[model samples]
Target: MSAFEHSSYPEVAKLTIPDVSVAALDMGCLPPVLKRFVEDGAMRMQAPVDFIVVAALCSVGAAIGTSIRVQPKAMDTRYQIVPTLWGAIIGDPSSMKSPSISFALNPIQSLEGEMRIGHKNAELEYKANKKIFDMKLKQVEA
Candidate 1:
């Protein structure tokens, strides 16, 4: 009986294993704004943080456009940051992919709507003031 002793029972079929590796998500790499969105989205949807964070970052970056730029000390040139990015939230139909994205974009959408309303009100006020000034000018000329 050596160190590799075998049982007296019948031999069983050997199982073959596949070579596979899984990569993990690194939340620390995310910026503060995106990290917060990821946590909030995960809590609301009861889903993993990885997908939510990616989706949120993409949405925010696209909305921001080229407002911000990235410059590296090691690099000779400055990189004009067009933060627009495309991401995929892959899951089955039952997964709350759309809902999570919508949740992330809700704040931005609401702000845009409010800005549009404010612009309309300002235009109306400007037109009204111009009309009053024009009427006064005609009366004085008469």
Candidate 2:
């Protein structure tokens, strides 16, 4: 045995992390309508374009769950895969998570407001129609 081998010496170990390759953003992955919104949102919010786009997609997907789905292959057993998703952004206190998400989802909030107004109007109309039908039924029964 060599002197170094016979002597009491510490062993040094080398560790290596594999190189990972990530593809560039493909705008085609998003619908044509949303591509513009994502681009605009990223610019307006002064955040990473990819982050903004992904967050927007996640929010929209949750909002429209079960309404739309994907069938990847004809031979698949399931009818479709629901487009539901959940996403979270973790960062330090100054990361501005709330502002970024709020900026990205402002359009959704606006649509929700419009929908609430429409629902209120529809409810009032239904109540009025029910009252009229009740009166008509009472008259017929008299």
Candidate 3:
């Protein structure tokens, strides 16, 4: 029971996500969760939902239902959710415009990934800074 751990301390803030491996995706193997299904002889996302919080939770839920094990790096939760919502909307190519299927998507630029989704760190900063597009104005004697 340390003084710092207590919520009463003004400096102490609650962690949005605990240090746990969530949203781990295995791109190598066949997707066991979502399998093709015959909806009026049309193949569609049947089992493992990806966009989230709709008919099937995993595909659309905020919580990490499926194991998305990839690189150990910080990623933008907001940016990541965009693709999920898009996938759900387009997963079934021939389906009617199911407006009830509520999902959100907005543009996101990969600034870097540690500080604010995509702002290059020191190592990457050095590489990016290497290409400065500034032109120096030479001083001429008047």
Candidate 4:
């Protein structure tokens, strides 16, 4: 008889799958400053610390951009890891996930506002320079 035959296997009255267990977040794993921020935000918003921590990590990863990379193995320089990170805070409706994420990303949002202003100023300067160059070219041609 082939082992693949259904009769070869023992029949069970019932099959049970154990529940998945998730470990709790360890605040010590985070830097002191970040830990404090997460703790404060969670307390004030009455949200889970995990949400803030994940948001903070994602924000940092985005802020770093593509300029930085990590080498998993020092001996193998061929492989490089980007700082890109994606995170989602899963919670039922009325949960404080939105507020927690907003709190964590506040600093990043502020920086983005400043960067936008700088970019607008640079764009205006470029337009002014281009107009001056065009006038100079017209004068030289005539």
Stretches of model 3 off by over 4 angstroms after superposition: 1-30, 37-95, 99-142
For each candidate, give its TM-score against the true structure. 0.65, 0.69, 0.19, 0.78
Question: What C-alpha lDDT, on a 0 to 100 scale, does residue 73 get in candidate 2?
Answer: 88
Question: How would you encode candidate 2's per-residue C-alpha lDDT over 25-139 as one tens digit per residue?
Answer: 8988998888888788777777666766767888788678788878988899687887667777765676667777887788888998999999999999999999999999999
User: Candidate 4: how large is its RMSD?
Assistant: 7.5
For all candidates in order, the CA lDDT equals 0.79, 0.81, 0.35, 0.93
**Best-fitting candidate, measured by TM-score?**
4
Compared with the true structure, the alpha-carbon lDDT of candidate 4 equals 0.93
Q: Model 2 scores what on Cα lDDT?
A: 0.81
In order of TM-score, best first, we have 4, 2, 1, 3
Model 2 TM-score, 2 decimals: 0.69
Q: Which segments of candidate 1 are over 4 A away from where they belong?
A: 1-22, 69-81, 136-142
